[model samples]
Target: MSNTGLMIFDGEVLRSIDISLPELQHNITGAQLLEISESKVSKSLSGLTLPPNLKNAAVSQVSDGDDVTFRRTEFNQQQASEKLGVFISAVADTLRDAPVVVSVLDGSMLKMFLEDEDDFAMLAENLFTDLDEEDKGKLCKREIRNALVHMGVDMGVPPLSEFPILDDIIKKHDADGDEELGQAQFAQLLQPVLQEIADVLHEKPVTIVQNVEIFTGSRLRKILADEKTLKCLVTKTILELSNEKDSQGRADPIKTLILSNGKELGLPPLSSENEPVALLYETIFSQLNNRDKQTAADASTEDGLMDSLKDILRKFEDLLETAPVYSATNI
Candidate 1:
């Protein structure tokens, strides 16, 4: 087993950083070394030079009883960067929201959709619409099995004689236990498969910061705890940054308008210099109620900030996706 520790700042540990021997060897940059060295020797500290090996070295100390051994080893920066990129990609992929599929009917609808057959379409068009309310409430086991068969055949899954899984699926959705699956039950049975397909078709990868709900909620919680930071972030976003233009000469009018309106409504101004734009938005979101938060988030999506965020996220995703395939030898 290897011992690991975090690189801490201001007494708070940043999450997901690994400072194990291997990691430290891989991530030690020239800038980091310069920073450490400069911080140590108060005045100028110019004319100092580092060993060539130090550029690729990992610094660590191991203690045994009263004895301590310091170790240093060389590692390639290209290799390290690739590994870090891969790690980031994995984390980004995990943060993505699962895809959503519209449910047509029970799990049977999934089979019909996958097969793209006329029979399934006919059944879908007539089944519930033709049946009376009472009749539409339940579908017999035979009907479910037929739908399952249609689904299984297309997917190369053989139908079992007992169809135990089918029975369980129906039972799970058969809320009334009338030995039949109602429309709602049918929809429930198909949800998982439909959702999987939906995810594949309409997948949108997002990081934790890009996830509106988590980003907003977490920032709000933090701001609420620290009123000073909250005020600073709010003032910067609404009063200053909103009017600032990007390289393309476009302003964030939606954010500007929203923040200005918020201030007009007697909302307090929070002041801070050089705060990050993301943090500013997070503070703004934190002040909103759930409904308002959602509304503001939705509005941001339409006003181009969402696209910018997505573009940034995609760049990271692309870097991570390609990292594993990158070769240090090529560099």
Candidate 2:
């Protein structure tokens, strides 16, 4: 009888297999293997077919003796942007007319009525009557927890003597540091995240200007022609923004937004010196401010685009050291 033992090697080591050669005889003929050399086994077996299920399945190769390998899917920017947009819209709509107190400590845990319109109205009315004169429109830690409990929201944590988490939540959202949360303070806590989400959702194409005086005009053309000078100016603008700090000593969000928008608009790896980074900043700032003006007239709009833009501009204007100033002469 012909020697029936068939060994399979994955890079010099034999791989374990429970199936016998008789099972694969129809797909891989003994005559075929006898004709091929040991070095040619891998190439010859490439055309061999296994069971239909196994043939269609994806098989991964392991070279470093690892039993398994993971394949990660590429990040899809467009899909992520769309999902963030939907989430932002949903949150904005939920809080538009509701007495919501979003936790600043854990911003993801928003406190809003999940009931129907009529139920919410009744709950608000009942809650209002229970409120003391001093706490009429404000929610303290105890009151917030009670309200949550009434709304059937489970805290999910083991009962503690004082629920220290509530204190942290109050401290973060309490703008005046009074251990309570008001509508205005709640909105403030929510604004930054909402603004970022809006920015991602409403990403417009970068307006590339060719005939602009600042970029293509006589004086700018000379400065921009030197690649080194252009790169220096762009780097300087970013550094200026990076050095700016807010009241909390954190990097200013408006400047951060401007820089982020600039990157998305392809400002860093500038295709041409004719596309001035300064113009990109100016364009983003103008578009944001103009959008605010247009949306401000509507008081009932849920997107809060106008409010978000105003907040960003207020921070931008308050920056003691502004972006590098550029002057343009007519063509």
Candidate 3:
């Protein structure tokens, strides 16, 4: 049996694991999870029955507060599998702006709303698809990729293998019997798991933006040997808060959206009135900047919330370096 992570969008659920025939182990067989589906377990398994000993197939869905009743199992796993990625792409887009509102106990309308949410694309898809014409992004690949990575994690591939600044080095041998990277068997082991997770996450709309570039080390040996080059990377997103208007209950709602690198030295807040949109860009523009000097790439994003959180940590460490914001009354 496999332990899996899943996300739900509307009538569809996005998955992080691939459910395949080979993976239908006895442990996860009976355990089932139901989300916003018109399909009934009885109906779907009518012809394709679960083994009598099946035990732990579970499912979950994210709520947006809509109510509905799923009486019949009308969903076909095969059909659901085909459209999973497309479904997830839609939900991802909707959630980026704001969470989709769901009403409790209104399953019928909720299903209808989910069906209508099909066209909304996810942010992960947006970032990748926008540049899709130029090239593929680490995030924008098929749900198959997502499944493979997750399965790889289960099989114990270090998550660091996916990092832009990292390399997934697979040596020719390990006494532990784990398949080495690039082996035909290793690739094959991932196929089923990949398909399942891809099917699921393709249904959910939540997008976790990880560092993008994923070309492996051997894929970059010549470039790294140094022809003296510069490149740009997103270090961390910076946000500046503002007191626009106080809500009846809440102190003050966010009035701005600022995405910064936090290195402009001294840029003033754009406003205290309305929402703001700002983005900070860090680049490797000169030959000298490419040298082994202190830079954003050397920083750690593997653990921190923001890319340059070290900077924030240092600032907070020194109390003398902080200042108070202007109060609403003062403004």
Candidate 4:
């Protein structure tokens, strides 16, 4: 895993980063700071650094929503430099507190195996043996696709769905045909196919997001730790719920509010309809006293609403830390 993807974050490394304008440049804008901060962080997470796609996504996710401090469009030279420092420090602090896990497939591992004669020979021999199941010294060339599947992500071979170029590579070599090949012939056919994939990957790496639930309660904890952010979220949800009332004139349930905003608060999204997630919410809601439920339902003032939201969020923080929930699909 370490060899296949850039490790997520190194707090010490991130904290030590010094952000500034290029030599002779005096000023910077919010957008430029964002670019510099992202570049520095990406560089620090070297080796298997985040591909452009993931890096851009992460930057947008972090800055666009609740963390709006980085969105200021302009600043004088001194202010820009100071704000840049502050933004980088905040990024370091947040990630150090709860780092997001990610993986990248850059095809370097395949290149390594292809470059080493002995390693490539052994890899070919092993693959041939695996595909040859019956001790028949020959295998149909079409088995090349299966061989790539067997190599999988760890070996730097992307899935057919992820990299359609592989299918083209196979057809180009006529390896998808029914022609049979012996061990040496198989090696000959595989070498060029792998080389082509490595070249393609060098140009365009894929960032893979595992679809596993995060049970760390990190997002919930972060929001809970910041009273201002938590209050803002509660206020925002309340307004949204009010605007989203049904034709019957009934406001959405507090539970619905929780479900709708789950992902932001470190729980699973409501759209998953995952049974375990539904059950978890049911358990939490069911256990709340009738008076507590009534209070949450009837609350109209900001303080009352905030208290109810805090209680519910605290429950989520505890339960999510104990159980996994559905997350976004892996890509």
CA RMSD of all predictions? 21.1, 26.9, 24.2, 10.1
lDDT top scorer: 4
Ranking by lDDT: 4, 1, 2, 3
Please report, as a residue range, the 10-residue window in candidate 1 with the lowest summed lDDT: 1-10
Q: Of the candidates shown, which would achieve the greatest TM-score relative to the real structure?
A: 4
**Residues 104-201, model 3: lDDT tens digits:** 11122222223343321232233234333544333222332343244232332223323221121111111123223232333333333323333333
Task: Give per-residue CA lDDT, model 1, range 1-331, as digits (tens).
Answer: 0011111111011124342223353455434433433233211111112222221221211111111221222226554444333332332233222111111122232344545555434544344334434665567534544454554423322244422344544455443233565665554444443334324323321101011111112222333355454344445544454456562564443445445543332222333432333344454344443335455455343334333323323333333233211111111
How high is the CA lDDT of each candidate model?
0.34, 0.32, 0.26, 0.70
What digit string (tens of lDDT, one per residue) describes model 4 on residues 51-104? 444454455554554346656566676665565666566656655554545557
Question: What's the TM-score of each model vs. the native?
Answer: 0.19, 0.16, 0.17, 0.44
Q: Which ten residues in a row have the lowest lDDT in candidate 3?
A: 276-285
Error of 3 at 218 (Å): 41
lDDT of 2 by residue, 1-331 (tens): 0011112211211122111222222332222322221213223222222222221121211111221321122213343233223322332232222111111111111212212445434554555445535756765534543443343212111112223343344345432233666644443343332233223323421111111211112222233245554344345544554566653564433444345453232123223343444454556557554655445333113233233433443433333124322222242
Instruction: List the candidate 1 regions with Cα displacement exceeding 4 Å.
Output: 1-16, 21-135, 140-212, 215-331
Q: Which ranges of candidate 3 are over 4 A from the true structure? A: 1-182, 209-331
Model 4: clashing residue pairs? Answer: 6-48
Q: Which stretches of candidate 4 lie over 4 Å from their true place?
A: 1-8, 23-29, 47-72, 99-122, 125-146, 158-184, 195-331
Error of 4 at 147 (Å): 3.3
Span of 10 residues, lowest total lDDT, candidate 2? 205-214
